[model samples]
Target: MTGFDTFLVADWSAAQGVRRAGKDAIWIALAQDGAVKPARHFSTRLDAEAWIAETIRAEIAAGRRVMAAFDFPFGYPTGVVEIICGAADPLALWDWLAARITDDARGRNNRFAVAEEINALFPGEGPFWGKHNRDAYPGIPYGGRSRTAEVSEKRACDISAKASSSVWQLAFPPTVGGQALMGMPMLSRLRRIQGCAVWPFEAWQEAQAVLTEIWPGLIEPAVRASDDLRDRAQVEGLARALSRLPLAELERMMDIDAPEEGWILGAGHGERLTDLARPNSLRPPPLRNDCFALPAGVDWTPVDTALALLRERLHPVTGTTKSGLFEAEGRILAEDVIARRANPPHPNTAVDGYGFAAASVGEGDAVLPLVQGRAAAGAPFEGPVPRGSALRVLTGADLPAGVDTVVLDEDCSVGDGRVAFRGGVKPGANTRKAGEDAGEGDRVLSAGRKLTAPDLALAAAVGHGTLPIREKLRVAVLSTGDELTEPGDVPGAGGIFDANRPMLLSTLARWGHVPVDLGRIPDDRSAVAAAFDRAGRDADVLLTSGGASAGDEDHVSALLREAGAMQEWRIALKPGRPLALGLWNDIPVFGLPGNPVAAFVCTLIFARPALTVLAGGNWAEPQGFEIPAAFEKRKKPGRREYLRARMRDGCAEVFPSEGSGRVSSLSWGEGLVEIEDGERHIRPGDPVRFIPYGSFGL
Candidate 1:
């Protein structure tokens, strides 16, 4: 169930500069109640270090559990840590770097000089390189790696990580060399702080405050244009992911045997992390086999995978009741509507004609006197025709007795109430036989079929005023959080419009389900629990957003722990990371993140499919089209992206920013550009998979 009491994620910077607000400095965010708290930026390394220490102490001393992640390499390749730090221990390198690498608040730092010093310890300029312009370091390679990492090794994770440049390459984009130089020093500072248990190097107990290495690429999201924003986004995303991670999964992440090459916090989690990239499970059906036990520590389930598993688990509503044929358009049929009587009840004329037995007619042209009485749609003649005579019949009228054939009145001249006909008259011509369309007691509509307009007509034709059908699904929508204000109301300082609730409500209605608006609830645990307890009695499903993170203020998450049950949270799909599924008082409940864009994306991805099944409809994969990328873009491996984009000039033009909080992007984007896993160098004309907003029924 629960892993950490207080969670923190820090986006680290290795670039040397007077940090104010950019990726070059530290950016941190707290994960609370299934969502991320607003980000905090540390302009300088010293400021970041001090804040981290204080924050950890503040939370831990208050009897809260703490787990914090820092983005950077925590250990080097085998033998490198031992040689440079005078021992093979991973923390030794941290201690060693802490004492060395003089970096200050000013942009000035001896990064190149320190690389030169570390190289001096090696036989010939090794394990690190790529010097800067003002660098004093010698024996540093300029462009690429001349040799591999220490002990000629690769991290177990390197094979799957193409976005991760080899640490041996040292500096520049994608390379960890510069980062290692700047990053190690900060981690080194952590070693000196009391009460911190460095992962892999030390055994991690839930009681001890823990510090682990994190790589953004391991759970990569779409790249953000602003450095500070990007850094914070990655950290906040990680924090939310780790909070819902299963303990068994966390154990695997902590069970790294290679102490020299400390594992990334979520490195081994890639297999499942990629699943996190899956869209959230919409009304996922309950599991069939005992195999329903889900893998632990998995936060992101791919949209496709989640759909397959969840749909397979569907325990479709089995109970049924009677509904009038006229009002059964969307209801699923629970039983067949059998024909009470044969359609038309007797042989009937197909069109207006003169009727007579074929044997009674002559082959050549002949004139016949019309019978005293005529057969009409609602009226029938009583007597059989004489051998040489004929009767006039109207469309849908029963044939007169002993009349087995009909002559076209149009082909003959009618004078003085008489019809002229040709001698050739076919038997049973222009007539519908009794029980031809539907026989007596025939099943007109089968069970498990959603009723359409034609079906209602068929039921009526079969003389059934009522039909058996399953009940309609009712959904309740709730938006939770203290920071939420009703949409259309001006948000006061630190507040946001509660967009997710109304949006979800409208979507449920659009799908032909009833949506009961529960409105917004402040970040109060009891209130959330009480609301669900009340709503579950009348609703088949409960949808919610906000206060889903693990932060102190995240009462919705807290309520889930105290009363309700939580099934899932966190996914690898872009725009929506904090998504939770659970049950409240036997009612299926879906918890979405607070960010409007993320909420919307998750709704379309997961809620749509899930709700469809619940509404007695089959689950179908979301349809998408292919287009060319209108602009240049780059992304790392290990995750899927839902880029907000519009089709412009036959190409998919994406919104420049990946921030889910920006409401304008939802309106601006026609749909999403789904980028799959692995490194991508998207040019202006590269083919991109696109799914439109309308496809989600926006």
Candidate 2:
């Protein structure tokens, strides 16, 4: 009875700019049982919405069960509920944001400006950071700390393969913020459809068209990440993947307890998320107006959304100082690299050769007479080239006035400085002109640019003796677990060394942040709180591993809830399941999973981007490479998954197991073989997606 007769996938777009077919426009795909279809494109998002509406109605009328999965977030991070809707209900927040953001049926919209407007409320550069036509909002940094630090990112059932995007990220391609902003309105309409139900928020019904969110990367992570591939490939591929799903598996993914946070259809939490009998109460989820996120067990925030949300409260520090050119390299510039002088300083020869006026040689002449004094580099000829004469000019030498060209030595033979050359020489050949590379007073490099070798060279060439730069950030790490011991010390029976603390410290150091170790906790509540206080006071960011989840042994989390607010975000990520973001005495704390693999995944997927932003670096996703599979796998739908894998002989070979606790699997792989949430039956030779660990700097 839970099986669906039809499966449809929508590859959504939130472009507020020009739409082109087979590219920026929306595409949809459909499948049923053994029948699957290629993707169909629409000229406008509205056209696609209209088509979906028609399909839903037709399916309902025909007495067939239809399940539709769209590629936009159905929910945002926690606390955003209050900021967005002024309500605790996640669906209400969706409706609110959907109403404020406008997308015409024709695809023309103000999505970019709207992103700027949303960012205005956040504390830093943005939760949203890319755009094509729009300039960034003034005073808003190009890179800064996450605004939505209130929510724990990894708690949402998101796999690390495809991170979520904020609702405010309306400008960039691949970022689904704009799509969610614009798409939600249409989704609200569908919710009101005669026979429709949005999962988790709306209880499922057999006759209703069950609508859910889908991660396009779930089935084709690397393919979707490929620049050469069109998004329709994702739609068509995922639609086919869904159609191939076993009926039992399909039902399991659909049945989850996601009321405040909408669930992804193929998150693969199916068996665990299956409908469970529980007591119903009038009590509702808590809403936090404080700095920390409010806890809600079931519907956790997606990682991308949480990151954007986290960035909302934090801002890039405005600590700037002047540094000499030698010291400026590898630093973030605080002021524009203004040019004091033009490059080259004066017109000079572009190559080593003889310089002469083209008119000096007759149209029929093959050779020219000699001239006085050779114009070698650094030895300019103050006088003009005499009529009917040539001068030997070395490369980088100033071209004599009235000389319009330079003939290479290889092209001519000089006897006593007199040049004999080819039949005809080109005008202005191999010459350098005054201010050719840059003009005086030109802003060679803009402010906020991280000075690299090329950037330093550019600034130095323009006579910049010193540059202004921002200070580096200070980061601290804490590990909390009863079973953890220091690696240097022998562990007691049944205890393991605390791997996450040192690992986080090392990761922070690699990213140019000052790392301060807060040491480890032995699952004691009071000790955990005191350690948190110390970390907050000593570092710009306080990070903790283990005790992030609400287990009996999660003493740190229990203390966090008592001292400050703690939100357990159930990110749809494999290897990691929960992320905690909290504030103790106004200091932001990042809580990660206890498992070394999960902690590392969360740090890569959430913390890395956040740290970069805090250090005035723009938010970016870790890109993946599309490769072939060397092994087969069978998995359920509901949670995104990551498998340690190595590229071998042109194929991606996955590790034998998918457990997060297996640190050896991580060490054994060069990268990860990603399996997007949902039922999947992968086989050898299939085009599988691989994300290299090196891409994340692991």
Candidate 3:
């Protein structure tokens, strides 16, 4: 996966004045390898543009991928592109603006004059609006849309992002019209460099430098909590957030193909971007253990005793590997995964309501003056609300400092900039506290547990990009008997295509192990011995089908016994009565029955859990539920039985045949019905334990 080694985010301004510092100033922040440097302030766009070009050049010289982001709209709405540059291409508009727009070193520009010139091309009023000195540009409307507007108020990306203001609204904190006028030329200038490419308009994956539009409001909670000015904090926070994301996520963010009306990065992933606002929390080392040697025994074992032995003897045999979250699904954790940051990252509102200090409200109905600005998702209120005043807050918006209580919008009556509400609401009601779900350093996932899709989401919410996973266990599988032939090959008379090797190999992969094919061997003792030797050298464990019983053609068992390393046990189980457990050249081997049905059942009931332990996980246990039986059976039992069964109409129905040669029964059934070891009679309504195949990690 390719990723950027350096990140830069700039908060642009359109003010025409001398060099200045503080709010509404040009601030550029740089981040690398999860660490953010102090933001550099610039009083003029010319100076900021020069510094950006120099930084990109230096980083590219050092062979680093660089992502340059700006906090402004990259293009206007749908039809505006065709009208401004007389073409549908967005880059053409950049060229158009670059040729007509002008700016200087002391923070001076002719953006208002350009807006006036563009407004003359439209009909009644503007597709452009809002200026500090609106009277000077009479052609541009002070507020409201044009009667004959060529474009919509907001672009598709802006609508999906729930941005507070349209690109045309320029008189407020969040507007970007004037900034776009001044910034487009800067983009056009930057793209002229040899290796710089504009995203969504040019190929960006292999470029040495990429430039894209960003919206810092997507992670306002992190910025609002900072002690620095809003402009500086937003730039630094966004740069750090982008630098920590994995390569796949960054690719997904820029997957949009908007060449005419360019898109904003992180537009639809608001909660995801917000959760990854901070980095460098912590991850403890992986747990290490190796205990996979079974005791030597040659006795008839009961089913319960065999299972107990496996649980007692098995432990992890694999090491750990670092994997990004995108590729970590179905893999077992090698240790506990800790949270990198608090969930929510800051206290936020759970409802669209009014927020104020709870102590200010008395027993009677309370009326409080409303604050000037409202807090919406991705756009938090700037300062703390007064003790006696209430601030309007939307769902998922961060609560301003000094406010701890909220009253739902429906519960309050509003008029004259004052909200009156019943006074019995509890403190912190309708508000979620910071770190309520999972705090920093909290264990989000445990060792030996297989990761699911929801687990990846939880880990990301706690600010993790990579995870520690156990290395996959390698299990070699082989078959014996000249009667079997590989699939996709010509077989001679009386020869059957091999089924057990393919079935077991597929099962091993689904259970998260690497399956190695050792091919098929004839019923010759020397050939079987050679295959076993090769398997021991190449795999952590070996699984062999057929030739376990003491018969004329049972060469696998004969070779193992001659080596003095085999333990042939007669387990009290139906269809899978004989199980050969032994070691060959120090590598464990499981010899399964030749019948397909028996091999599948034994692999699930015994080998699945054993393989899990050997793959750096804990003992695997399948969850079963008792369901009413739909068939009747009479049994005089000294052994446990697993019948191929499927669920229908809330009852367990077993297959008609119990023969080990009925291979199709494994596919006909959804799971197995376990019958206990006892003399018993079962009727149609009797409860039987049914375990689904999925419960065995199939």
Candidate 4:
């Protein structure tokens, strides 16, 4: 649970016009609390090293655990080389070997050669050559490896795997490869031991390629000459070491001291890092029913107006309560839930068979005297059976005392006083262990989780008599237009069958709202006013389809102004336009388009989110994907457009009939292609963004 709090990154660079130059380090301290501390620069290795030591010391003193990274070597020399490993002491055996080699005898012969050559001469016997040497030597004396060496290696490997996996899993193409490449660098930097560079250069290159493929944007910008060389070396070393270490061991090591436990470093590095990066969870806002007025001469005015209208109209109503298990079939939870008791409260039998001590079962058709012990749904055995004894049992029967295994009836033959088993039986077989299904104090449901059938059953199993759930919103739906008529009813001349009402009603029900049908009202000013009056008195929200435009027949707008306070703002979107939003007698009213298709589209674009808000849920603008277009089209500037499109062969193909009135276009559509306002034209095969309806939870 403890997460990272900060990231201290050192970007080492060489000063300009400097040859054979050491690094000019750039130290960046990133606080998890959203503060970016001033960047510190060092012109020389000594300065950098001193600064790092001081910073780490200060951080440690201040109760802040800091992870300090350096763009230099940290691994012990495999040969005679002493790499830039941490401040840990070398192994005891290594120290002894070094003493021997440097002594008059060995040093005179090969001590002058490079560390690699000297190591080659002695091989396993050399201080810095092999694992055997490390095992024999004592690590840094103050922070001895005896206590933490095993744990650290394990933690490092686990962290490496998690980082790699997370990067590779990004859906965005560039992100995947970028992370893959960075994996090597991260590993190399973290796990550089004294005697071995477990992660090598080769592995780092491979990871780099993967990182480049996944996140070109990130890798490209960071791949400057000053930092590239050190980064490559570091990543390679880390990746190679990680590939070899056991993931579990690594996790254990990192878990040793966590922030929650008042320790500086924690386990599950990726999770910790994410916490450090963003401590707060991202929560969206609730949808609103506020309308935007359409300008004159605009044909798509209803869409914007309807959305604005819906925001104010959909106010939250009703109170939250906990219902009985059987009654909470379709309610969202108001709070988290923990199991009152463990499931399968006690150990019980899972099979219908004899339950006897396994030690009593003998080889080859053994027959023991049968005991008259019964275990039923509510009854359990009271006493243990004697040796060479068999008990008769049924399904759901509790295992009798002194019994460990159960031989199925089909596999056993009844005898004079015992049941003979035909096959071998194991101890504790066919037994349902207590707390296996659900542990005591286990969280069964988190807060805000919707209660489903399985959840109800789980709650019952945990002995819950009732479950708390959020209050449902009270919504009143009204369809407007003289041309609209209910389905299966004979439509008079100039009347079209109503589709928006039924569709809107179904959608409302799905969103956990108590919807009231206000029926249909003709496109008359008085009728619209009467509908609003009825909705205001009866429902928390009033929803209407059509009459949102400024046309003379669009009376909902005028009625809204006559009844209550309303403000309208035009949203730059496409498809269902001419939206009208207003409030009537303290009740919000959303006036949608009369066209069935346009009305449905607008509802999804606006109404659904607003309802979500009314239901006390966060509602944010939905996200979409940018995909290659399969068709070319041109549009007027200054308006956002949504075209129904199907993804064919990974390409978005706009439907042939691309009009707001064509409801069928949406029915067969996989997603909506979003053309930004003022982007007048798009060519086939061009990349355009699209929002899939499913992403909106629709």
lDDT of the candidates, in the order given: 0.70, 0.70, 0.83, 0.52
TM-score of each: 0.50, 0.55, 0.58, 0.45
Candidate 2's C-alpha runs over 4 A off are 1-298, 307-314, 362-365, 433-437, 440-450
Pitting candidate 2 against candidate 4, the one with the higher lDDT is: 2
- Candidate that would win on TM-score: 3
Number of backbone collisions per candidate, in order? 30, 47, 0, 68
Candidate 3, superposed: residue stretches over 4 Å from native: 1-298, 488-490
Q: What is the lDDT of residue 444 in candidate 2?
A: 91
Give the per-residue lDDT of model 4 (tens digit) for 62-161: 5543434333222222321232122233232233333433212111222222233333433232322112133332321111222321111212322433
**Least lDDT summed over 10 consecutive residues: which range in candidate 4?**
208-217
Q: What are the per-model C-alpha RMSD values against the true structure?
A: 28.7, 25.0, 15.3, 26.1
Pairing residues by index, what is the TM-score of model 3?
A: 0.58
Scored by lDDT, model 1 comes in at 0.70
Q: Which regions of candidate 4 are displaced past 4 Å?
A: 1-316, 321-324, 334-340, 356-370, 385-392, 400-416, 419-427, 446-450, 465-472, 482-497, 509-512, 523-526, 549-569, 578-586, 616-655, 666-698
Residue-level lDDT of model 2, residues 619-695, one tens digit each, is 54688988889998888877777888999899999889887878888679888777876689998888888999877
Candidate 1 versus the native: TM-score?
0.50
Off by over 4 Å in 1: 1-300, 317-319, 356-369, 383-389, 400-412, 421-430, 433-437, 561-564, 569-572, 615-659, 665-698
